[model samples]
Structures are given as structure tokens and as C-alpha cells.
Target: MTASDDPVLTEVTGRTGRLTLNRPRALNALTHPMVRRIAETLDAWEHDPAVRTVVLTGAGARGLCAGGDIRAVHDDIRAGGGAASAAFWRDEYRLNARIARYPKPYVAFMDGIVMGGGVGVSAHGTVRIVTERTRLAMPETGIGFVPDVGGTHLLALAPGELGTYLALTGQPVGAGDALRCGLADHFVPAGRLPDLLTALAGRDVHDVLADFVGEAPPGRLDAHRAWIDHAFAADTVEEIVDRLLGSGRPAAQEAAAALLAASPTSLKVTLAALRGAPGLGPLEAVLEQEYRVSCAALSAPDLAEGIRAQVIDKDRTPRWSPASLAEVTDDDVARFFAPPAGRPLRLATGAAPQEVPW
Candidate 1:
């Protein structure tokens, strides 16, 4: 798709419908409009017999998607809370659920910086492709936000304590670690993505798999695995942070520093959400918890401050409310899981997991 028309492009290639994120300059950070268009196109193609499969990727080599348009979401929160912005999240989460349960073979080339909202679009696909350039994360805590777009669900599904570690610390995992954690299916080199996509356009999943000709890069996270597994094994975010701080390992120390820099309240609530999420009744239940948390995040002092410092001001120093994790009470975290006055998440029923397209 050309940049002139839409940031997201939809094209039919044989029986495959390709959705390309087309904002290279911004690393294809998803705007609300982009999400809407993608959802609309997917809805159209879902039941269209003409389209047998769907492939989602980005336009440039730099990244697949950096995440949501946090600036827009931040602006909405600043304006005021009402139906308009609330509806955007509702629709976005619904799209996420639909993608998770999409009937056709859905393939996501999770090339780079597939964090936050980007994870929503690509992680739930039948096939998740990782490349050497892929830098996958769920870094909402850093910005006073809980991981949304059904990220909690995926995090819950990740191996061992890695999900909690990621939620609390916002650490980036490379392709090998992503594969180890079940976030990605196959590792392919960046240079070969086009030819693979070209081959995938006219063929079946089996054919596409057969055509793949790339080797996995050397794993980067192996040395830190022991620390990651142990430190994040703590029951709470505070405990995890404390353990990391005391570990004395350089990586652990750096990670602790990063966590300390994030909004304390964000860390508290995100940890609670990730731990509680796995037992939630369904994806919608988890999303409802996330929605409540997200709305509450707007009201909290840190969100706007984080956005101002990080995006608007570009100052890189947010003065977070409840400046330390110890100051954030459990009650504060609990409020986010509670439902709003009347509206609740309207989730779809009858979702069943399908075979992962190899």
C-alpha cells in the first residue's frame, strides 16, 4: 500500500490477502485509524471464500510495528474520558480477539519491535515468523500502562516466569528467546522475507514452510536465562525488583534500574494483571481486566507524565506518582481490575484453538 492512501494496505495476491503496515518512518506504530482499517479489512475477508489465507507484515526493513499510537491514546486521555476513546479500545480489543480466533490461516511476520499493540496484531496468528531483527517485548510498565491487546493472555502462555519478567521489566527478547518462549514459530533471516512472502502468496502453509531457507541466529539471552528465571520467580513485582537489585549481576542490576525508572503504579498493576490473568475465565475476561486497568491508568498521574516525558517532551525523565513501587498499595492495583459503572467488554463466544500453521 502507498503512504498516500492509507498507513495500512490490503491487497489480494491469489487466494491470499496481504495486510501490510505502511508507516516506515514511524516504524509502523499503529494509529487508531490504522487499527480500524485493519479490523475492517479483516472483517471483510474473514468470510470471503475468495480469500483463503491472510498474511500481515510491515512495509519497511526496520520494524514490523513499534506498538500503538500512544501519543493519540495519551491525547484522548488528556481530553477527557467518554464513549469516544473508550470505544476505540473496545473495538481494538475486539479486533484482537477476532485475530486470535481467525478461521483462515493467518501469518504474521514479526520482524522487529513487536511490542504492546503490535503484539496484539501478530502474536495470535496461526503462524508467527521471527527474524534476526525481531526485538519483541511488552513494555507497557515503562510508560504507566498495563499490557493490553490481549498481551496478558500471550504472556500467561509464555514459558516459566518469562512472562512476568517481561511484564515487570519490559525487556526485549530476540528471535531465539522468542522461539523458546513460544512467541514465534520459525526463525528466518531478514533478507529472505520477501521471497518467502512471495512464495507464500500463491501456496499453502505446507508449501510456504517447504520454501523457507533461513537458519536461526546465535541465541542472545542464554547467559541471562538463569537470572531471568530466578528473579522473576518472585511472587510480586516489588519482590522481583528487590531480588534483581540484590542479585549483584550486572544484567540484573541494569534491569532493576530500568524497572525503577518506570512508573511504580504501572509496575504494580501489571504484575497483578499478569499473575491474575491466567485464571481469568476467558480472553474477554482478561481484556476486561486490562480495560479497567487502562482507564484507571488515564486517571493516575504517571501515565500523562510518562507520555510527556517520553514522547511529548522527549525528556526521558518521568516524575511518576507513587514514586516508588512500595508506595503503590494493593488497593490501587485492585481498582483497575474492577469494572466500570455500566459498560463491560462484549466478547465473542465459541473460540477454539486451531492447529498452528507450520
Candidate 2:
């Protein structure tokens, strides 16, 4: 790979197959090539007797990963690579499914900001580690995209209507909240990471984690759970927003504003995805539905406009089509959920051994 297309660093260290996302400059934002490389490495190591576990981390101090490189998707749209973007999503989603179902133990070191596609890479692993500095979210609606990466599946399982609140608002939560919400399994300080990595080399995954797992910082989500569940229990985004507005609390009012600021179509479709996720059978099924939404997004003006406003122009102002929630019809949401005309997500089967399915 060239400098622009740098491969994610992969190596076999002792009994561990280690994968480090090396693109610190862009927050290790995943590329299609990077996704393919990771999947290939995992496939090779799955059956290797010497490699009993896999450890995934990022190279920088700032964060583990931010998300997918959507700036490239913006360029693709400008260059009319609608088909290319679709292919990229297809492969990325398949890799996500693979990681979730890997035969061996998988651990993720989510040290910092982990969002969108970052969650896709780490959250499905058998063990997910977060630091005090970690800030996690699936902030897709801000950019006119629905939560993909099996996010809807995981978010759907969060206690009460917390999933709907997160899906619509795209709020960042800290390590404590991450653990409280089931996004992370362990908490380790950033300073202790090196020692933790060293421990992984000589000990079992569970044993090492048990030794290093410290007291998780307190999370406010539990305190706010009642309000969140009450405000977000409505069937639609509009009703949720109305409920928040009526609550008269500053936090509730702020949440209402956040929901209003997001792309209408994204908000509507994401809510639909979250509500529908619980009924979806498995990670593969969630990914299949997400593939349809992602492919459908290529033709939607909001995805391109959202990217241009957020990434290309570096402006926070996005002019979403169907600018208001009321303008987003049920039909508009249904179009996104519908399967596309071309080939669907190709999920591999029968080649891997039995283990705990993520």
C-alpha cells in the first residue's frame, strides 16, 4: 500500500495476534483496505495453534479510532463513485460480522474517542476495554447517516429507551457510562496500558483482565435513566422530542435541541433501525439491514451534504433535505430499509470453529 493507503499494522506477538490501527493523524479512521487487511489477518490466525487470542488497539495517545474515513466517501460522491461507496460498505459490514463471530478470544483497547465505525471494530469483540479518557458514541445522525456496524443491535439491548435517546442525539458518553450502557467490559487507566499489553503476552485473557481491572469511574446515566426512559419512550422522534420539551429540565431541553439539530431523514431512519433491531435475529442480520441503509444513502443528498458541511468545509451547519422531522415521511424511511437492487452483503460461513458468537 502507498502512503495514502497505509495498511493497519498486524503482527503475531507470542500467543497473541496483535492488530494496531496506525493512522494516528486521522484518528485511525478505517479505510476499505484497512478493513480488508484486518479481516484477512483474523482469518489466517483463527486456526493457527500458536495464536490463541487477538488483541486490537490503536497507535496514538489521542484515541483508538474516530470512525470510517467519510471524507473519502465525500470525494467518491463528487467523482460519482456511488457504486464504489456501496462496495466499501458491503466489505466493511462483512468484516464487522466476522469480528463479532471470531472463533478465538478477542480483546479491544478502546483508549480514547471511539465512535461510528470505531464501535464497529471493537464493540463486538469478546472483551472490550476502555480508559478513563475514552469517549464513545455512534454519532451518525449528525452526518445524515444511520447507526451501522451492528450498532442498532447493541444499542437496542441497552436498558429501557436509552438506545433511542442515544441514536437520535449522538451524545458522547465516558468510560463509566460506556460500562453502564454495556459498550465496554473493563476499565483500565491509560498509564497502565503498556503493562496490560505486556501481561497479555504471558497470561490468559481473563486472568490478565482480572488483575488489571480497576474501579470504573462513576457514570451519570444510571441517575438519569428514569428521565431518559420517560422522555424517549415515544414511538417516533417527534413524539420523543415533544416529551423532552415538555419535561422542563435543562438537560431535557438540551436533548430536544440536539435532536432538532440532526438531519431529519437520519433521525427518522435511525430511530426506525433502533426500534427494529431487537427483532433482528443476529449480528449478520443487523448488518444485512444496515447494508441496505448504507447503499441507499449513496443516492441521498443528505449524506453528501452532511459530509461536505462537516468534513469538507469544516462547517458545522448542515442543510439536510427534508429539513424538518415532519417532512420526513414514512415512505422516505421505508425506502432506506428496503433491500437494494444489486448483490447483497456476502457473509462467510462454515469455515470457522464454534465459540461465543458476539
Candidate 3:
């Protein structure tokens, strides 16, 4: 797509390569074209001596990004079957890996509702900045999906069972909680974002960031860390639910309610994915596994059901196939990890010789 038509706005300002998620109307929800554009721009900027750093942000005030265009994915699933949806995940995950491994100073101005695909793009960068308005989450499970975009890798690295708690509950967190969870590196006020970008033109990015960094307000996650660990420490989801129910604490009760409301298959697969993530060799491995789950999920109908209930019909009630946690067996979860019948995601291990196609 041309610059005017593109959802992502890319430009070079002095020594910095800047990208703005331009789809403000859609809350900067990423499409395949947008993802490819970002990957290509980053690739081009990586080798350019003139570009010392990269700055990413979203347009308008809603926040950096909401996530991928799930409505579009829903349409793709309905019309073109799984091919289009699979292709999007494959490309999107590849871009996520690229961001995580980018060598230069990559700064993300995560000031709004950063979730799912937003987290995929920004959280993996070298310097992740969250503002007071920042609300972040890896909330794919709510949509009958496991958190992809190397989310499992980041979740695995979170303190103790917090990753399990966040992944299963799909809870949105603020700047302080984001920092406490290792989701963000610094907290900058939303009003100062323009100054941060302006400073990036001539000054060192670190100096600019340090100058603009503000103390984040207190977060509740640390206070409940013990409860979170105790409730989510179980080897299985059922056990975790049992623990939560037995805890009698308000936080445990809330978490249990959230988990119970999520898709059964998504909960099972997400639990297994996060549990097995630490042992996975690399980010690419996690992406590969997630790709398998996403592709397999296309056939399960929960994805479509989720979109219908949550986004399309606005019913707020999803009729999951397994229906209950007991119905989601080991075999059901295992199938999600199996290799796709078509092609597996082949992530770039090093610098690429050719531009990644859309």
C-alpha cells in the first residue's frame, strides 16, 4: 500500500526512524499489510547508518494499539477458511520475533490500550515505555485464542505464577502493574510523549527517556503476589481453580470468575503453553507452538463463536465446544500443539537478505 493508504505511518526524523500506528479509527488494529510494512521498515532502518534508533507509537489518544484486527480475522475465517487467518498469524508472529531480536535501540511509546498484537509489537522492544493511560494485557484467551506473538515467552519470564494468572485471567493492567510484571521498562506521562519524540531527533534516546521518565503510581499486583502464586501454583487448571475457590480471598475469587468465563479450550491450551514455555529453546519455538494452536483453533469453532459473541453479536456469552473444563482433555490440548498441515512459521534467525513479502 502507498503511504497515504497505509495503516502505519513511517518516517525518518534526523537519526531516528519513527513509526506511528495510523489506524486511529480502528484503534490501530494491525492487519497483514501493516505488519509487513512495519517489518520491512525496521529491516530497512536496521542497516541504515543514519538511523540510530527507532520510535513506535499509535495515532490519536486511545493508546498505542488495541490488538490485531480480529473482526477481519473473523471475516477471513468465514470466507477464505483458515489460509488467510493462518497467513496473518505466521507473518505477525515473525514480525514479533523480529522486534524482540532487533539490535538497535527500539523504543515503544505504549500510552493507551496496548494488548494482544499491541503487546506483540511493543513489549519485546529494547525500551518499552508506558504512560498513565496505558492498559496492557495478553488477553487472547478471552477470544478463544492463546496469546501468540511470543506472548508465552514474555509470560514465562514474569515472576512466579503471575504469568499464569495474567494469561488465564486476561486482565488489563496499568503502567505500574505493567512494570511490576516486566511488561514495561519505564513509565512516561502521556502529555510528555511529544517531547520524548522531539528529543529523539538530536539527543540520545536513553537521555531523553531518563529525562521524561516519571514515577508510576502504585500497583496492586505486588500486594497480591503471594495470593496469585498460591492460587495459580497448581499443575493443572482444575487444581488452580480448586485452589482459587478455596482461597476465599477477593482477588482469588475475581481471578476464578475471569478464568471460568474464558474459553475452556483456550484456558487449557494457554495453561499448557505457559507451563511448557520456559523449557522452549527460543522465542521462535514459542511462536511456532502458538501458530499450531491458532491454526488448529480454526477448526474448533470457538474462535468464530467468540468473535460472534464478543464482537459481532455482542452477546457476551460464548458457547464453547468443550463447554466445560472437564470436557477439555489432554488429547484435546495436545492436538493444538501438533504441526500444521500446511507450512510452519520459519522465523528469521539472523539478518534477512530479502524483504519479507506481505
Reference-based TM-score of each model = 0.93, 0.95, 0.96
State residue 21's C-alpha deviation in candidate 2, in Å: 0.4
Summarize candidate 2's per-residue lDDT along 1-358 as a digit string, tens digits: 6643455887787888889998999999998888889988998898798988899999878889999999998888779757778877877887787888788889999999899999999999999999999999999999989899989988998888777788889999999988888888999998888898888877779887877889878987788787799988888889989989998888899999999989999998998888888787777778888989988888898999988888889788999999999999999999998878777764544334222244
Ranking by lDDT: 3, 2, 1
Error of 1 at 274 (Å): 0.7
What TM-score does candidate 1 get on C-alpha atoms?
A: 0.93
- The best-first sequence of candidates by TM-score reads 3, 2, 1
Model 3 spans with C-alpha error above 4 angstroms: 1-5, 351-358
Instruction: Say which candidate scores most in lDDT.
Output: 3
Q: List the RMSD of every prediction in angstroms.
A: 4.0, 3.0, 2.2
Supply candidate 1's per-residue lDDT for 253. 94
Q: Give stretches of model 1 more than 4 Å off.
A: 1-3, 351-358
lDDT of each: 0.81, 0.86, 0.88
Q: Of the pair 2 and 3, which is ahead by TM-score?
A: 3
Q: How many residue pairs in model 3 have overlapping backbones?
A: 1
